[model samples]
Target: MAQTDTPGEHASVLRLPGIVLGVGLGGFADGILLHQLLQWHHMLTSTDQDRIGVKYYDPDTVPGLRMNTVWDGIFHTVCWLAVLTGLAILYARVTQDRRRVWTSRVLWGWMLVGWGLFNLVEGVLDHHVLGIHHVYAGDGQLWWDLAFLLMGALLVGGALLLQRGGRPLALPAGAPGPDAR
Candidate 1:
């Protein structure tokens, strides 16, 4: 007889979807709040305003605004892809193992981790290292950058605590965890 269910086939599968979703949402939040709403920065806004290839565009000019808008569209596309990919992975995992609970502690914990990871990577690479953009590109930019990193650290730390405090979310043997049918 063929095996029907594989609950433990892929350990750590439950957290994958949440993490991806968080990462995508985090990206969306950054793009919306910082780039769109506050108008603090754009995708290619940087200190080196005259860089070749990816030249910086002023937010005031129509051509410059168009350039930044294009780059922003690209960024949003990537975030959208992340969400779709996460959903695909989640569907596959859920079908494979019906016991995976959507609201488990592990899922929430990893989601926070993923969001934090996004902020850390984006903040460090774009703001500090590459100078591509900062949370607020102006005098005392370092303060904003540090604050962003601090927020990321807090998210990661909080996630670890949540994961540690909760009991492992697993249905007991012979128990039906979810009803797909």
Candidate 2:
């Protein structure tokens, strides 16, 4: 990453905010769609004592759903904090070329990268390692979980390609920034 003696020009500094923002937003999308609207799974919906030795919480039951909902709310709260942190970082770093950076494909690409990372990490931890919940519970749930990871990988790949096309910001590290567009 090039440094123009300017903090905003630093490659990682510029990209970090966008990715963090994307992670939070992506998590919100997942929680809302899969957990709330679709009623697919909750924080501990997949727990089975035999498998993981954790008490199962049946999402169909009121008490069980209540517990799951509480955990889900906590997850969302963390995501909200992440979004705030990301925006705060962006507001601090991008002191110039506000319009350009805001519209640049690089920023968008970084955001996608963040979202993909969130999906990949969360899918692995929650759906696979922890087995707390699946993308969709019940039969063939593994397929759903795998599909989620695949989408994340695709998003990251596509985002990298998109970033390559975003000139100026996309310029190789150590290169000078192009004049304001």
Listed in order, each prediction's TM-score against the native is 0.80, 0.84
Clashing pairs in 1: none
Report the lDDT tens digits of candidate 2 across residue range 44-150.
88887224767887878899989999999999998999899888988787665566776777778888888899999999988988888899877898899999999
Total residue pair clashes for candidate 2: 1
Each candidate's lDDT (Cα)?
Answer: 0.72, 0.79
Maximum-TM-score candidate: 2
Residue-level lDDT for 41 in candidate 1:
88
Q: In model 2, which regions exceed 4 Å deviation?
A: 1-10, 49-52, 169-181
Q: What lDDT score is found at residue 11 in candidate 1?
A: 27
